[model samples]
Target: MPKFLIVGATKFEIQPLLTYFKIPVHSPEGLFSTESGPDISALITGVGMVNTAFALGRYSHNLFDYIINAGVCGAINKDLKIGEIVNVTNDTLSEMGAEDDSEFIKYPDLNLPGTNYYENQVQIISSALNGLRKVSGITVNTVHGNEQSIAKVRRLYEADVETMEGAAFFRGCSRLSENYFQLRAVSNYVEKRDKSKWQMPLAIENLNSFLISLIEELEK
Candidate 1:
């Protein structure tokens, strides 16, 4: 049996996955253990890159055949409405490079002074999610809203979605097993923070449907 891992920023992101897979939630770490449904596991690491990297790295060591970092992200492409899913093809920490004078430095790929990315597993994961709805992801430490940062990222990486944890999780998995994936469901746009504009509830509902299909596909 191939052990599968699922890491998310919060319980809400992993709730549909857990329920659909019938995995019991473990507190403190939100690690769910199961023997059925692709032999998958789930964890709800708190928010941010540091916690997400640590939680996923610790949980993924020598234990899983495949690791999935699944969660909610802010969409940049207006075409992707809230509740749509985005398959991360590759992740880059959009805000990692150094800034000098007035120009932002472009550090070598996967060579950020303090960050990480899994180059090997990215395409493999992308292949698995190939036919699914997708948009490239660029992870950022800061909660983005300004048009300036959005333009920079769009120009630099050509990413359609901006997320907080995908790059961190991918970086953490670099030394671990080689099969890792990331999927994000858009809950809101990377715009002015407006609670009324957030589609969290709808995103969760859509996530439930996505997980059901994903599990079925992976099973076969």
Candidate 2:
């Protein structure tokens, strides 16, 4: 069986899923016991862009066959409410490139030397999430947006949601292997970090259920 590498942004995002898999809580860095999980390996790769990239690059150094970046994100579109899963179709850094005199130097699909550029893996991931309701494919990056920025990203990328780690995960996975996918769930709206409005708990529950089903399917 091909090994699947499950990457979560934090333990909060992965706790429920870990329970479903019967994976014992070993350490903060996610060193799982073979007696706990059968086939899957989970890693809690901190949060945000830089940490996520570093974790991916470090662990994916010919260590794993398949990589799945799963976590909670914020909804950019009002229609996509809380506790919804969003598979990443494509991603771009919201703070990449350069700032010149007046214009931001946006690099378009340029695969520099050995750096892996963006690619679409949504269809494959969505296929796995076929019957799972309230799931979407999103375009995510590091920076959360204001109204104007959200509007611009939605217009340009047609993304249903946004996040901080998807782009970096994509870049890292692309550099490592081709059999990787990104799965995200919405915990709050894009406006602000309102804990009262966040559905993190519910999202984790749904994410856990989703992961269990996916694992069963993979086993079959």
Candidate 3:
């Protein structure tokens, strides 16, 4: 059976899947069998890149056949409605380079020490992922809440979504496995701070729902 690792920034974000697999909250890390599907495990890496990197380091990557980074994200495109799930096919650390007064220079232009952007190398993990919108995303140290910064990022990356951990998760996976991908549900638009407009609950619910479907497809 294909062993899988489901990585999330927090347990609540992935609670539905954990419950679906009948995997308890505290012991989702080790290999488990559900009596009907492949062996699976999960990791609740705390928020942000640093925590994710460190959390991933605690495990042996060689044991899993697939790794899926799951979370909620802010949409850059107005068309991507709240609670809609999308596959982040590519991601980059948006703040990895310095600002040249007015124009921002990317890592490639600055000749950085390590890669700043990554594309999904994993071809297929589950057929359930085939029909979702494939989108480009940018990872940020601070989520955009200002109009000026949001516009600048829109012009710079042309990204469909923004998240705190996607790129870091991608980078970590680059060294750990070749069979991994990220999936995110839109929680809100990348606009000024407006907690009233955010739909975090819906995003989490939708994200876990899709993950459950994906796991079912993997069982077949």
Q: Which RMSD values do the candidates have, in order?
A: 3.1, 3.5, 2.4
Tens-place lDDT digits, model 1, residues 1-220: 5677777788877787677778887575657777654688777788888889788666654467677787888888888878887777677777776777977776664364654333433554333378666557777778777778667766777677887888887777776667777778789988767879998888877766776576566656
Q: lDDT for model 1, on a 0 to 1 scale?
A: 0.73
Model 3, 1-220: lDDT tens digits are 6777899988878888888887656553333334544587788888888888787877754567778999999999899989999999999989888888988988889875778898896788456898889999999889999999988888788799999999888888878776889999999999999999999999999999999888767766
Q: Which of the two candidates, 2 or 3, achieves a greater lDDT against the reference? A: 3
Local distance difference test, each candidate = 0.73, 0.67, 0.85
What's the true lDDT of residue 37 in model 2?
A: 40
* Residue range 158-189, candidate 2, lDDT tens digits: 55566777778787777776678777777888
- Model 2 segments more than 4 A misplaced: 30-33, 62-65, 100-103, 109-117, 122-128, 131-157
Instruction: Report residue 189 deviation for candidate 1 (angstroms).
Output: 1.3
Model 3, TM vs. native: 0.91
TM-score of 2: 0.80
Model 1 lDDT at residue 204? 75
Identify the candidate with maximal TM-score: 3
